[model samples]
Target: MESYFRYDRMMPREYQRRIAENVIAKGNSLVILPTGLGKTAIALLVADKYLREGKRVLFLAPTKPLCEQHRKSFEELMKLEKGDVVLITGELNAEKRRGMWEAGRVIVATPQCVKNDLKKERMRLNFGLVVLDEVHRAVGNYAYTFVAEECRRSGLHLLGLTASPGSSKEKIEKMSELLGVKNIEIREETDEDVRKYVQPIEIRWETVEFPSEMDEIRKLLEQMIEERMEVLRKFEWIKAKNFRSLSKRVLMQVRERIERSSGGVKWMGLSQHAALMNLLHAHELLETQGASTFAEFFGRMEAKEKKSKAVMRILKDGRVKLALEKASQLKVDHPKLEKLRQIIETGKGKMYIVFVQYRDQVKKVVEELNKIPGVRAERFVGKREGVTQEEQKRTIERFRNGEFNVLVASSIGEEGLDIPAVDCVIFYEPIPSEIRNIQRRGRTARTRPGEVIILITKNTRDEAYYWVARSRERKMKRVVRGMQKMLQDRRKGAQSKLTEFV
Candidate 1:
């Protein structure tokens, strides 16, 4: 017989009901559910159980906006008084927050605020349960670690939630250890129980060929990178046989080696490698992003006062200058831009969110999108982009109300935001992280069927990134499955031990 609890508060789907029951029984759990699949619903169910027992619950999110968002959801779903569910953020003064902490039964706060409060002794770590949203960030010196440690010390029930933990096994292990996760519940979009609630997402890939002019500039940049690599080879700073085959990871390793070395030779090698990496990044931007992005980057480099001879050498090169000029005078927009325009055109009365990797692209994309009649577009960026939290809130509200048919956003739009379902999602370019790729795609196909269009530039870094994200997503699923299996086996072993004792 299937048992359900808290159905009166928020009617959860079958999978959510099962997962919540399991998590509540296990206590310390890491729940990995896809976006729009009701991870928050599970948290609410568990929170209700804790609240009924006259125990306080603390929900931690990564950002203030997410904290505020969760607060609203809790207020709406949970059968609690408006004052019982309180939001604590940096905006609140210490005294005011302390009062709220004492008064509120369910608290939604940014982890940093919780960490600060814990440090100041303004807030007690006596909660019966702590929910960490975006728990993949639990690793390292993030506030999630501090809060989790405090929770463990106080013997509080912990529930960590994320759409994607990460692709690396080491990162997953570290995050699990930090949260003291005793069980992991992972469900993919294709899971049998999950399929009913998952609206179908049609993923389309559109490939564009680089223009001949862009190719010429690419070759020039590659040549410059080769020259720098040659200098590094003379010093034996790098042992790679083919510079073209070298990856960003390999270059990062080289950087670590340079950091550890000493003397003038090390300094020279560092300067050369730095210049090479910059030029390579520029090459990638031109090939994958757009000439405008490449031009802006090169212009910044050119305008910045040079500190190293190697930087001066690359900036002063005739080929570099030629590439910059060519990029500035490009006769056409990037091919991806045209395809994006086409995708939007076909989706006429529908809403869309276009995800770009850079802030500058957000402006450029919004500008290009606004050129089309009936296409109202706006840029959504982070606080660093001069967008205040209030401004972000307003933008999302307007986007939700259909004041804008399209939202051109940076990576900020990818995680934990309450974005409305759209008819389509357009990836300005393929990202290399499976986590981001999943988040971007999660923005649509939420309430109904939706489409995803990925713009990939053939024979460029875009193609490579597309494959990298795909491969990582596959690996991540396998890793999550293994973790789930291990947790199940552990539970069974403990059960067997109890039976033997009986």
Candidate 2:
């Protein structure tokens, strides 16, 4: 059946049409493509085909902003009347949502809203196809996981889409199993067919020297971490006292073990764990983030000392007092801030999205960037940080409209949001996760050629994180390709068996 819809603004690229055709032919398909390469375009094309077949389509994204973005695209791309499509989110009253669901031929929704609807038996999987954007999130207890399971049970056609599914084979396979998608379609920037559409993104590591003044702060925090780890080791909570072995993951396991117990020992371990975790965070601020960020963190801890015995104990420690004093007395900014100013001054990019890891740093980065003449920077953060949805939407719009040249955002800007393509993306610090690494880099190089500047603090976790994400991104491609081949072989075998039976 031919789709009643057409790309009225711009014609669909040849590769997008091919991928859409492939997904429609394959029963349930997962499409992995680099960001800005029109993954959503293929999704719309597939939705159109199903719509023309006289079946409804469900477009699922992770956030309300994303859902609204797709809703606009659905209306803009085709000749469908306004009543033919609708946006249903949890923000709407359940009764109104049900009405929209009944009236619209297509629904663009957030997974949480759909999950809630399903949980209350407000709706069934009545659609012919469910388009799962950011499909890699369909794992564990995520709302996406629940919706994917429901789609699987209904045996509806699934068109899963993502830029990065992560580098872990186990997690990817687990998500694949959850979505019940038996086929995979993967594309990379290097692929011959996709190369023409993918604008080249030049990723540069802008290494910055760690400030010498914060050395005492980091050293003191490391000593504190080691002391706590030693006690945990003695309690048999951990196998060894090696500080390197005490990653956040390992500490979380220790926390889990402590929570599962009930005794004086458990109480003691919890105290030690609490202090250790706080100290580790302080150390990270000293290393990866600047002195002002560390001071903000230390000040918060000092304020909490009145209520938390663990915090009180940490504050009373002699070394911690010295570290806090030193951080407060620091006169120089982290070298990365200077480097960032230089990048903006050079005018390499007219617009910039500076990806900061912490909210505290988001404010600091925006402050610093705006100090540069002709630079108008604003902080963009999450709802937990008190940035309402309307505020976030305005911030992105302001940045896009050139009201601000730089957008210093926390992790929230890395996913699902319909942020426009900037000329350059600045990573305030390297992230260890491949999924985020890809997403942050994808913010640039969207339509035209783009630049990615990563700020790496020398000899800190910044360098370590950069390498880890790079290695994992490479590994992800290999893992996805292997999964793709395995699925194709199995599919071919099934086809031959059916042919023989016929």
Candidate 3:
């Protein structure tokens, strides 16, 4: 095997080297390696090819901490001097960054900042390569898309990296297209090259009851959701067989569809759509999440300033009122909480990361976990929730230092935050998104054998969502592999035509 980098110690494994060579050969590749399988190492090897050519490189991560992480990894592994790698942040003046752009061999920054710099003409695409850390987000109007367009415009080689690039085929294809990815590389844990490096992850589930009273509330909310849907269906606005089968993704379109409608039907459908969303949310909270979360949802809606007619209609519903009273009358929290506490108490792991979907549940989980003796847990959330980046970094550092044995985080923890040495991952509730499921599972079993325990409430979306995500994960791997094959065939076809012409 040809050695790609002479930066001193630390060489890539056979699989990493092969992938890196493939990426270098393919030009503008999207790498879908599982988390912790050394995607950065592959990038480092590829970057060496560019750096040796005396060209600059740009690494784009979604967040500042991630940017710092990639920069540190390149510096340490490549044995680069401190001045060689630049960490660009908004804190620095544009002129300072402009100077660093030319001065540094490698630059790392958030996509938003990079896009602004590119727009201001302060940064040039003179680099040999650009690496987008979470490239699955390269769709739509995200900053990643803008930077990717610039790379294509400059005819610069670019690499997009992500562990789980979503399960939707259209979304994946769009991401590949927008990023100008000519080749898609996906490696499964079952692959012979990858299986040896990945440890076994045992997955199991603990079931909790959907308390009878809570079931009553869920039924009430479901009735409301179905009623709205039924009316919309009569109006030919929705065509779902049942509300239970309808997804939030589908329901979200109703608002836009309503807006495009004319006359009295527009406001009518809009009101119904809004009510359906609110009812569905309340039902999900009561069924899948805890009562306190449900109450919080209701409270937030009530607290909204200048409520819309739809909101007022939902607030005035007798069923909604009765359900709220019933939830308040109940003394116990979501059964999943007690189940989670029990699992943490008896779990064999030294450190646990609990993934919850709701911010209310994140705080609730932390409060519940800390109640256990000898358990130190902290809530990890996003800036929108009032937690600053400094606080987030400090919380992660504290967790890493073992000051906290458990980190109860929302969706923010699902991605590439690098919470190390996690022995187990617990899902506070099952989510239907396959990307999140894979990301959450990747939290554990990176370096050591670990287990994942899912808390499921029987006869609810919790169980249904678990199945949906698992099925979609399997389908996602197939989708990405299909994309890879498609690209390969197209390349081959192009080559054959060129040979014929010759």
lDDT of 3 by residue, 177-238 (tens): 87788888788999998899999999999999987767777778878888898899888888
Candidates in order, TM-scores: namely 0.95, 0.96, 0.95
RMSD list, candidates in order: 2.4, 1.8, 2.1
lDDT of 3: 0.86
lDDT by residue (72-131, candidate 2, tens digit) is: 888888668868888888789997776677778898899998999888888878999999
Q: Rate the local accuracy (lDDT) of all candidates.
A: 0.86, 0.86, 0.86
Q: Which stretches of candidate 3 lie over 4 Å from their true place?
A: 1-9, 496-502
Ten residues in a row with the worst lDDT in model 2? Answer: 240-249
TM-score of 2: 0.96
Error of 2 at 302 (Å): 3.0
Residue 453, model 2: lDDT of 90
TM-score of 1: 0.95
Error of 1 at 44 (Å): 0.7
